[model samples]
Target: MKKYDLLIKNGVVVTTTDMYACDVAVKDGKIAAMELNMDEAEAEKVCDVNGKLVLPGALDVHTHLQMPFGGTVSADSYLSGTRAAACGGVTTIFDYPVQHAGETILGLVNSKKEILEQDACVDYAMHCCITNLNDGEILEEMEQAVAEGITSFKCFLVYKKEGMMVDDATLARLLIRAKELGAMINVHAENPDLIDLNIEKFLKEGKTSAWYHYLSRPEFVEAEADKRAVHWAKHLDAPLYIVHMADKEGLEACIEAKRQGAEVYVETCPQYLEFTCDVYKREDGRNFVCSPPIKGQESQDALWQAIKAGLIDTVATDHCPFQSYEKDWGKDDFTKIPNGCAGVENLYPYMLDAANTGKISFQRVVALCATTPAKIFGCDNKGSLVVGKDADIVIYDKDKDFTITLDSMHSDYDHTIWEGKQLHGYPVQTYLRGQLVYDNGEFVGKPGMGQYIKRSPKK
Candidate 1:
C-alpha cells in the first residue's frame, strides 16, 4: 500500500510569512508532509506541478447565495456559488443566513444548513444575521447559536427600511453579549437616516440615476457609522468586524481604533480595491451597484495602502449578484435595482494578478485571501499549508495570460463586472481536502461534496 494518498512536487510553496521550494504530501484528506524532496514512490498518485505556485485555498468570509433581496433572489444557488468559488481557488465560504422578525437564530441556521449541505461544492460556515431583537430574546439565542458552532453574528446598521437595521441600543447590547459569549459581531456600517435623507432628496430632484446610488451614501454616511461602531466595540471591550469597508474616513476610523488597541477588524472587497465611482458613470453602471458603493480614487488608494501596512485584515468578495435584467429594474431608479455584483470567481485571480504584477507580494496574497480570514473567523483547519491541516490547495500559473468574460465565468449570471479585464496569472487547479474539485478550467466536483464547517468561538 502507498504510504501517502497524493504527492505534489516541484513547485514553490507559499504561506502567510514565507515561500520556498517544497514538495507537499497528502493522505486521508490532510497534509501528510512537506519537505524539499519527497519520494514519488511513496504516494498513490503524484502530480508534478513544475513551474507553478502552490498556495493555500482562500476563504471568502462574506457571500450571499440563493438569497432573496430587492424583490428577487440572487442569481447563484449554493451549488453554482461554490462552483464559482472552486474555480477561483476558494475552498471555503462563509454565508450569511438572515433571521427575519419572528424567527429564531438557530432555526434560520438549521434551515440554511439543510440547503447548503445538499448543494454546496465547497466547505462552508455561516455568520448568522440577527435582524429582530424580539425584546432581547433574539440576543438570548446568541449563546445557543455559538454553542451550535455559528460563532459569528452579523447586524446591519443601515437598511432600516428593509427591517434589517439594528438600533444603537440593540447594537450595544449585541456587542456586550458577544463579548461575554466569545463571539464576534460583524456590522454593515452605514447611517440609515443619512442614506434615507439623501435618497429622498435625490429622488425629489430627479437625480435618480445609478450615479445617485454612489451619491446617496456619501463618505460621511459610512464614516460616521464606522466611527460609532468602533467606539461601541472599544468601550464595550468587544470584537467588531466591519464588512466591505469602502470609504477613506471609515478606514481611518478603523486605523485609529486599532491603534488604541480595540479588537476592530476591517474587510474590503476587490471592487473597492480595483474600481472607483467612475464605474457608476458608465452606461453599464447598473452592474456595479452594491452596498457601500465603490468610492473615490482617494478611498481606493487608502485601501491599498492599508493592505500593505497590515491594517486591513482580509479581502473578501461580498459575492451577492443579480442578473442583468434584475438590475435593469432600477436603471432609471437606483432604489429598485438589486444591490450586488459578481466577484467570487474573480476574487483570487484579481488579487493574484496584482501580486504577479508587483502590486503586492505573493505572501501578502495568501494572508489576505486565506490565512487571516481563517484566523479571524476561527476556521482552524484551513488557511495554511502545514502538517495535519486540511489539504485545500491551489496550483497557479503565474505567467499565464487570461481575460475575464461572461463565458469564462462559472457563476449563473449573464453579465460580469470584470468582463474584458486581463490577468497575468490564474488558478489552473483547485483541490479540496486532497480531492481534485476543479482542474484545467472545469469543475469536476459534485454538489454535496462540501461539508459544513463547525467554527470555534473567538474567545
Candidate 2:
C-alpha cells in the first residue's frame, strides 16, 4: 500500500511562526508527515513545488456570500464564492447566516448548511447574525448554536433602517450571554444615529454623490461605536470582535481597550488597507460603496502599522459584491447603492503581494490571514501546515506577477474594485484537504466538495 496519498516536495514551508524548506506528505485528507527530505516512491502522487512557498490556505472569516442586502442579493452564491476563494488560495470561509425576524439561529444555520452542501466548493463554517432578538428566544438559541459549532454571533450597530441594527441594550445582552455560552460576539461598529444625521444633512444639502458615503460615516462615527462596544465588553468582561475595522480612531479605541485588559479582537478588510476614500472620488466611486466606507490615507497607514504591531488580529475580505448596475442605483443618491465589493478572489494575493514587496513579513501574512483567524474563530483543524492538521495548503510562486482583472477572477461579479492593480505574488496551486481545488489560474474543484466545519468554542 502507498504510504501517502500525495507528496509535495522541494518547497519552502511557511507557518505562522516559522519558515523552512521541507517536503510534506498527505494521507486521508490530512497532513501525514513533513521531512527535510522524503522518498517520492512511497506516495501515490508526487507534486514537485520546487522554489515555491508552501503555506496554509487562508481563511476568510468575514464573508457575506448569497446575502440579501439593499433590495438585491450579493452576486456570488456559495459555489461561485467558494470557487473564487479557492482560486485565491483560501480553503475555508466563515460565512454569515443572518437570522431574520421569523427564523431561529439553528434554522438559519441549517438552511445555510443545506445550500452550502449543495454549492460550496471549499470548507466552510458560519457566524450567525442575530437581527431579531425575538424577546430573548434568539438568545436562548445561541447556546444551541454554539453547541452545534457555530461559536460566534454577529450584530450590527448601524443599519437601523434595514432592521439589522441592534440597540445598546441588545448589544450588552448579547455580550453577556455570549460570554456565558463561551461564544464570541462580533460587531459591525458604526454609530447609526450619527450616520443617519450625516446622511440627512448630505441629502438635504444635495451632497448625494459617492463621496457622501464616506462623508456620512466619518472616522468618529465608527470610533464612537467602537469605543462604546469596547466599553460594554470591558464592563461585562466579555470577548468582543470588531469586524471590518477601518479608521484610525477606531483602531486606537481597540488598542486602548486591549491595554485595559479587554478581550478585543480587531479585523480589517483589504479594501481599508489598500484603498482610501480617494477611490470614491473616481467616476466609478459608487462601486466602492460599502458600509464603514473606505477612510482617508491616514487611516489606511494606521491599519498597516496596526498589522505590523500585531494589534490587528485578522484580515478578512468582507467578500460581498453586487453587480455594477446595483451600484448604479445610488449613482445620484449614495443611500440607494448596495454596499460591498468583490474581494474573496483578491484577499490572499493582495496580502501575499504585500509580503513579497517587503511591506510585511511572510510569517505575518500567514498569521493574519490564516493562523489567527482559525485560532480566534475555533477552527481547530485549520490554520497551519503542521503534521496531522488538515492539508489545506497553498503553493505560491513569489516571483509570479499577476494583474487584478475581472476576466482572471472566478467570482460572479462583472467588475472588481481591484481591477488593474498589480500583484507581485500569486498562489500557483491550492489544496483543500489533500485535494487540489485550484491549480495554475483555474478552479479545478467542483461544487459540493466542501464539508461543513463544526468549530469549537472560543478560548
Candidate 3:
C-alpha cells in the first residue's frame, strides 16, 4: 500500500557479498523496499531489467582527479573523471588529497576543497597524503582530518628525495597515529633506496627506454617494501591498506600478514590484471608507464589466481591520466614520466571481461570492484543494493559489445592504454540515487551536484 519513486522489477540483484532475485523499490532517493513481486502501479518509474545483472553502483577508492604531478597536471578533472566513472558503472570515487612540499595539512585540504566543490559530478571522498610527518604540528592535524571524516592517510615508502616519501621512522610514527585515531594507513610501497640505486644504474647504462622503468623497480623491490610495510604495520598494530598490489609476491605478504593478525588489505588495479610488463616494454610502452610498473606475465597470472583464492581484496582504477605528449614526459628520463594510467571508464567492463572469460564470478567482480571498496572505505550506505540504502545502481548489459576508443571515452587524456581493446559487457545505464547520470556513453548530470562523502568512525 506504499507508493515508490521507481521500481526495478524481476532482476537478479547483486550486492558485494550476496545475490537475490527481487523487485527493488525506490522512493525519495533511497531504497524503500525489495520484494519478490511489486506491482508497477506503485511506482512512478519502472525499468525492465529482463534478467540483466542489477548491481550496486561501484566505488573507485583510488583515483587522481585533476591531480598535479611531475610538473604537469593529470588530464581528468572531477567533471571529466567522475563522468567517465559513472559511464563505467561507478557511482562513487575517492580521490587523493596530495600535499605539496611546505603546505599544511589543513591548507592542502582547503585546496582540494576548491577543486571538488567546483567540479565533481558523482559522489566522492578523499585520502589525505602525509608529505611531512616529521613536524609535530602537522602530525597533530592528521587527527583533526580523521575527525573530519578523512578516515585514511597515504604514505609513500619510496621517492624519498622527492619529499613525498616517508622514511621508516616517520612511517612507524604515522602508523601509530593511524592506530590511535582508528584511521587506515594507505601505503605506496616501493623501496626508495633500491629504486634510486637501480634508476641511477640504469641511467648510467643509458637505458632510458620505457621498459627500463619496469626493470628499475622489479617485483623484488615491491615485495621487499610490501614485507617491510606489513612488518611495520604489525609492529605498530596499525590498520594498513596497501595500494596497487602488482604481483603474487606482494599478495603473499598481505596474506601472510593478515593470517598473522595484521590488519592489512590489498587493492590491485585493472592494468595489473589486464596488461603486463610486455605491454610496457613494447613500442607502445610509454603509454602504459605507472609507478610500481606493471610486472611480468607470470605475476599477472598470479594476481588473477590470488583473486580467485581470496588473497586479493579489491580492484580500483588508480585513474591517473596525462596527455599523449605528456605521457612522454619521462622520455627524457623514465622517472620523470608521471605515474598512472587511464581506466575510470574501463574498470568494471575490463573486470567483466575477466568474469566472462571464467577468471572470476559476477558476484566476485562486484565484490572487488564495488562492494569491498565501499565497505573498506566506510561508504556503508552506497555500496550495496539493499532496501533503505541509496538507490545508486547500474544496469549491466551482458550482451553489449564495444571496442574502446579514446573518441568515445571522457578522460582529458587524448589516449588510453586500453585504446584498442574490446570489451564484452558494459553498463547500459547508470543511476545515482534514482537519477540517470550516464546513458549511451554520455553524462546527463551537471557538475557540483555530487556530494562530498565523509567516512564514519571505523569499527
Candidate 4:
C-alpha cells in the first residue's frame, strides 16, 4: 500500500518563516506531512517539481463580485471572479455582501446566498455590510450573524447620498455590538463630509478631469477619517480593520494605533502601488479610475515601505471591475465613474515579480499573500503547509518570465491597467481542498465545488 494518497517532491517549500526543499504529502484533503527527500516509490501519485516554489494557496480577504454601483453592475460575478482568482493562484476569497438602501440586513444575506447558489469556483466567505441600519433591530441581526459564523461586518463612512454611509453614533453602536460579540469591524474609511465638500468645490471650478478625481479626495481627507475611526474604535474597545490604506498619513495612523495597543489591521491593493493620480489623466485613464482614488507617487512609495516594515498586513485586490462600455459611466463627470478595477487575476503575478526583483523576500511574499490573510480572516486550517492545514497549495515556477497581456488573462474586461508590465513568476498549477482546479491555464474543476465557508469569529 502507498504511504500517502499524493506526494509533491523536490520543490522549494515556503511558509510564513522558512523556505526550503521538501516533499509534501496529502491525504483526505489535509496536509499529512512535510518531508525532505521522501522516496517517491512510497506514494500513489507523485509530481516531480524540481525547480518550482511550493507555497500555501493565497487568500484574498477583500473583493467585490457582481457588485451594483454607479447605476450598473461590476462585470465579474462570483463564478467569474473566483475563476480569475484561481487562475492567479488564489484558493480562497472573502467577498462582501452588499446592501442596498432600504433593505434589511437579513434580506441582503439571503439575497447573496441565492446569487451564490448557482456558481462559485473557489471557496468563499462573506463580510456583511451594514446598510439600512435600523433602530437596534439590525443590531440583533448582526448578533445572530455572529452566531452563524459570519465573523466580520463592513460599514462605510462615505456615499452620503446613497444612504450607505453610517453616521458616527450609528457606527459607535454597531462597533459596540460587534465588539461584544467578538467579531471584527471592517471600515471603508474615507471622510464623507470632506469628500462631499471637495467634490462641490472642484465641480464648481470645472475641474472634472480624471486627474481631478484624486485631487477631489485628497490624502488629508483619508488621514483625518482614519484617525477618527481609530479613536472611535479605541473608545468602544472594538477591534477595527481599515480597508485599503491609501497614504502616508493613513499608514502612520494605523501603525501608531497598533503601538498604542489597538487592534487595527490594514490592507492595500495593487492599483495603489502600480498606478497613481497620473493614471486618471491618461487618454484611457477613465478605465482605471477607482474611489478613494490612487494617491500620488510619494504615497505609493510610502505604502511599499509600510508593507516591508510590517505595518500593512494584506495585499488584496479591491477588484471591482466595469466593462469597457462602462468606462464612460463617468463621462463629462469624474465622480460618476464606478470606483474599481479588476486585479484578482493579476495580484499574484505582480507580487511574485516584486519578489523576483528583490523588492520583497520569498518568505515575506508568502506571509503577505497567504498566511496573514488566513489568520486575520479566521480561516481555520487554510493558510500554511503544516501537517493539519488544508491542502490549498500552488506550484509556481520561479524561473519563468512573462509579460502581462490582455490576451492571456481570463477576466471579462476588455483592457488591462497593467498593459506591457513584466512578471517573472506565476502559478503552473493551483489546488483547492486537494483537488486541481487550474492547471496550465486550463480549468479542471466545475462550478459549485466552491462552497460558502462559514468562518468562525475572531480569536
- Provide the TM-score for each candidate, comma-separated: 0.99, 0.99, 0.96, 0.97
Candidate 4: which stretches are off by over 4 Å?
Answer: 1-3
What's model 4's lDDT at 287?
A: 82
Worst 10 residues of 2 by lDDT: 94-103
Name every residue pair that clashes in candidate 3.
330-337
What lDDT tens digits, residue by residue, belong to model 3 across residues 123-222? Answer: 8889988878546776788778877788898998887777788788888988887778878889999988888899899999899989889999999999
Question: Which pairs of residues collide in model 4?
Answer: none
- Overall local distance difference test of candidate 4: 0.84
**lDDT of model 3 at position 432:** 90
lDDT string for model 1 (1-459, tens) is 999999999989999888899999999999999998899999999999996999999999999999999999999999999999999999999999899889999888889899888999999999988888887898788889888888899999999999999999989999899888889999999999999999999999999789999999978899999999999999989999999999999899999989999999999999999899999989989889999999999999999999998899999999999999999999899999899988999999999999999999999999999999999988899999999999999999998899999999999999999999999999999999999999988999998989989888985
Native-to-model Cα distance after best TM-score fit, residue 291 in candidate 1, in Å: 0.5
By lDDT, the better pick of 2 and 3 is 2
Compared with the true structure, all predictions reach lDDT values of 0.93, 0.93, 0.85, 0.84
Residue pairs in clash, model 2:
none
Task: Name the weakest run of 10 consecutive residues (lDDT summed) in model 3.
Answer: 130-139
- Model 1's C-alpha root-mean-square deviation from the true structure amounts to 0.7
Residue lDDT tens for model 2, 1-459: 999999999999998778899999999999999997899999999999987999999999999999999999999999999999999999999899788898999988898899999999999999998888888898888888899999999999988998999999999999999999889999999999999899999999999999999999989999999999999999999999999999999899899989888899999999999899999999999999998899999999999999999999999999999999999999999999999998998998999999999999999999999999999989999999989899999999999999989999999998999999999989999999999999999999989999999999865
